[model samples]
Target: MRLILVNDVSTVRGGATKVALQCLEASKDAGLTCAILVGDDGEGLKPQFAGIRTVALGERPLRDGPTFTDVFAKNYNRRAFEAMEGLLQESEEETVVHVHGWSQILSPSIFYALAKHEVKVIVTAHDFFLNCPNGGLINFHSGDVCHIKPLSAACLATNCDKRNYFHKLWRFRRTLTQWGVGEEFWSRVGIVLVHEEMEAYLRYGPLRHFTTLRTPTAPLTPGPVEVWRNRRIVFLGRMCWEKGVRTLADALNKTGRTATLIGRGPLLVEMQRALPHCFVPGWLSDEEVARLAGEARVFIMPSRMPEPYGLVAAEALMSGIPVIVSSSALIATEVANNGAGLVFDSGDAASLADQLAATDDDDLMRRLSEAAFSLGQRIAPSRAEWARRMVDIYMGRSSFSAL
Candidate 1:
């Protein structure tokens, strides 16, 4: 059987693309016939994906700031449709298409193209795009989770887009086009959720058919870290309001704790101004981030939105670094229940400050670090094992397995 991977970018821009590239590498190593289709020119193809078959569209990502044409083209792109149709025509009879991401460039037109083919298609829910119009299920204006049913009167009337109502309207239009692709198209498609806990939000939408597939992440450290010697509290990811960077900054200020901010986003300037004493290095390489994480006393995932997975927090746990995560994140319950991390009220600086203070207990730190390492080892799978599981799903072997 032939397997094809589809995503918006060929390089590792974020967790979704990183997972896609890793899957591609693992699939090839497992002796599967695999190819990748991406929206960009594939200029930044990493060393591991060197010899793999790749199809790049040479299109600019809409996330890089949409143009006049991108405004309308994001809903449906004839170029992407034709490209997919042509690719499907040449593929083997028994083929599977696994899509990691598309909102950035490919658009919903690829779905229409897939509807014409007989191949099985699977989409990973890296975010809420399959259901929520804003792809976050967050009211950006209010900094709260949005409970309105998608496309309903309440949803349509709400201005939840980060930019403005016009952008929200555009997203609504795109979502309508996406869902209108017909029941037959959707019936044959299977959704892969990164975290099963995300079902709480997705079940309220039209698509209920799905399975959990945990992305593989190698542990940064070989074993539990020496948590007592470390003093830095680190927060990594986009510096945005939804990510709760401001909240983290406020908490650190209140506690007078030494913290490091690693990432670049709209809120970076604001965070820098808020915490003049803390380290605010813009963005670092993967190795640097991992090294920093290994040395950190605690990692923080201060997201205000309902993060589907929070991969970095999991990575921190795997590295034996305890985390302080927001209850709004899906992994917060697991980390708290496993004794791997502390859970703070989402968007609450005071609560986060209290947790920061609690981390000072040496015995408590040691226990939490050990538990965090154990939890990480338990959840993280080998690359080969993860690839085998992907093949099982592709070959129609299992569904409904929990991670």
Candidate 2:
């Protein structure tokens, strides 16, 4: 069996990329031919997949465009779709095309090509772009989840996140184009993989055509307790509006607990202003972030948007730190179910403060910490296990039995 893993980037650093790489590894272990196609060449791209055969689509077009829309569309047109088509045709039959991310680098054109070639396709919903225009299903300016269907004009007109009518209209136009093209080509997709149950919420809406596969994630386990300390909280991932940095700041202010905000995003200045007591460490190497996670008392994922999965939260749990997250976050649900973390009200700083206050009990913290370690072992998919699963899928096996 042969499998082709398609993504906008080849780096295995992020959650989606990790999943893709795991699949590639799984494919190879299962005695299947595996190849990767990336949309661009970057420092992280090639090195991360050193031993694997990879094809980089070079730099995407319109990268220098001033507006987000212009740059996004240009890259989609120039790289994603074209590369997918070229790679698909060059590969042999019975190939499983596993797609991870596509919005920024690849346009809707790749779906059409897949449809034309009669290839078997499986798309993993790492985020919400398949059903929402903004991809996160988040209103950018407001940091709120978009409950409305992306196919609706109301969703387009509301300019949900940008809060600008004109910008909303512009977004709507682009989304409409993408949606129409996708519907025409992707309606026949064989499967859609989601990490949690919350993804089912989207099935009844606009993306009802595809079959849903709910895959479980493994949790993180901390190395040692020597670095652990009390009253030190950590925030990981992008510091953007959807991540609820403002809300996290408010919670910190209420609790008077200082936090280390690791990761970079568009809302750095705003987060700094709102939480003067908090430290912004910027983007750190995975090793650095893991080290910091070990030192922290607790990790918080205050995202207002629906997190498809909370890789950072898992890391925190693995590091023996408790995690506090919003109920809307899928990762939070997993954490709560595993008894490894606490869940707060979505977008409510007060609720987060309450959860934090409750964590002062050392016994409770210890119990949660232990649970986190156990859950981490269960949730964080090993490189070998992921590889085996991909091979099963490529071989037309009904389940990832080896996983």
Candidate 3:
């Protein structure tokens, strides 16, 4: 089978890109012809997929309009859909299009083309962009989950996160238009893959017509490194409001436990001011982050949102480190089920502090650490297995399965 993966960026900047690259590697292992189509090119990402064929859509100008209330919202690069249209025309009959992220890159035009060609298309819900305009279903200003349905007047009336009520209204209008166009084209999607069961619930509850698949992830290894001193607790992901960085910092301050923050985001300044016990190393190389994980005592994921798969949590578990996650995080379910970690009340600093204190018990930590390592083996599907499953679905050998 010939497979083509589409995403917004070529770099492994986020979980979606990481999973997409992993899938590409898995497909190659399965002896399928694979290629990647991306909207942006960056030096940090170029070497990650050295031998892979990648096509970058030419840069285009930003849309001319009134800027959103939040300046960050204006940092969007409009994508040229025509490039993707041309690419699909040259694809073979056996081609399977796997779309990861597309809100900022491939527009609705690509879906339209795929529908017209009757191409087998699979879209992974890496985030909530399809259903929510903000992509995170988070109010930018207040750092809260959005409960309103997509394209609803409530979503339009209240600026969920972008801080500008007018922009929220504009986004709602755009979402409505895109949904109409998407439904017309994507109603025939071969499958919709999600990383977690919680996402499946949300998708089925909102968009029930599509088939869903749940495939959790494991850690990436660069061999093993010598363990270091210091009872380090690491937080490794985007440093954003939705991630509950402030909450994590608050917990550390309240508990008097030192931590290392290992990612960059919009709230670094605030985090630094709030938590003196925390060390912000900014963004580090994957190698550095993995090395730190091996040395750390525990990985803390304080996300207030429903994290789909929690790749960081899996990685920490695979490295034999216990994880402490917010109860609301979807990965917390996996951690609790697998005995890999402990869960605290979501967004509660006191609860997180209490959980931290409990980790000091060596016996409990040892038990959880062993469970974490074992669970890693079960969750991390081999690349070959992932590829086989993809092929089976593409070849119509497996019946439609819902997550």
Candidate 4:
């Protein structure tokens, strides 16, 4: 069988593209015929993995704005459609199309081509862009989580597009078009959810009819499950309001706790000034970040946004580090259910401080460290293992759902 990976970018920057790259590498190692189809719109050095098939159809229009045409046939790039059409013609019968994300880079046009070819497809929910009009399920004016039913009149009317009503109208139009395409595309494909909570959300929203399967991921590499010391906490990922990193730093400062911020973002200098005790070393290599995760006493992910897949938390767990994540986050659910770490109320600074103080007990840290290590064994999948399981799903060997 053939495995075709589809994502927005040719380079790995964020969660969706990184996972797509991982699948590409693993599928080739497992002796599966695989190719990656990307729109090289995002700025980065293109990846050139040896002995792997990598195809870039074209780039998105520089600073392209949407029009009524985008709501119609213009959403499909002619080059990408041709590329996918050729790929489908060659291996249409046995090809499994695994689509990661499609927004600014790749649009919904390719889905139409896949539908025409009747190729089996699997869509991984990296974000809610497919259904939610606002990109994330967040209210723009209020900066709060939005639970409105997707595509409803109320949802369409809500100006939650992060800019203004004009932007909201644009997203609303795009989402309307997406709903049309997704109805046809998802009906002919199965869904892959990184977390069960995402399954719950999707089942009750758009694409609810499509079959879904759970695919939990582990860290890329296993770190030594070292003993826990009373070292400072570590915060990885973007340092922004949406990530709640600033809130976390505020809590840490208020509670007199110190931690390390490993990422760079708009609030970096402000955060450095506010949390005088916190250390900001900017972006580090993944190896260095993993090493720090292993050495740190605890990891904190106070995301105010609803993170469907918590890769940062999984990586820390692999290193035997417990997480103190937002209660509303999917990772927090994993920690609370499995004893991997503690949960603070989402976006609540005082509650975060309370949880941060609770981790001061050495005995509790040791217990959490051991439990996180055990959880890592369950969540972390080796590359080969992930490839084999994905092949099973591709070949109709397994199926799962909350239903």
Models 1 onward score TM values of 0.95, 0.84, 0.85, 0.87
lDDT of 1 at 356: 95
| Candidate ordering by TM-score (highest first) | 1, 4, 3, 2
Answer with 1 or 2, whichever has the higher TM-score: 1
Roughly what TM-score does model 2 have, to 2 decimal places? 0.84
Checking candidate 4 for backbone clashes, the offending pairs are 218-380
Worst 10 residues of 2 by lDDT: 219-228
lDDT-based ranking:
1, 4, 3, 2
Worst 10 residues of 3 by lDDT: 61-70
lDDT of each: 0.85, 0.68, 0.68, 0.73
Positional deviation of residue 367's Cα in model 4 after best superposition, in angstroms: 2.0
How many backbone collisions does model 3 have? 3
Identify the candidate with maximal TM-score.
1
Off by over 4 Å in 2: 28-31, 48-54, 60-79, 163-167, 181-185, 204-229, 399-403
Q: Clashing pairs in model 3?
A: 139-160, 139-161, 140-161
| Candidate 4, residue 389: how far the Cα is off, in Å | 0.7
RMSD of each: 2.0, 3.9, 4.1, 3.4
- How many clashing pairs in candidate 4? 1
**Which portions of model 3 show Cα errors greater than 4 Å?**
42-54, 60-79, 141-143, 182-184, 199-201, 204-230
Give residue 93's lDDT in candidate 2 (0 to 100): 56
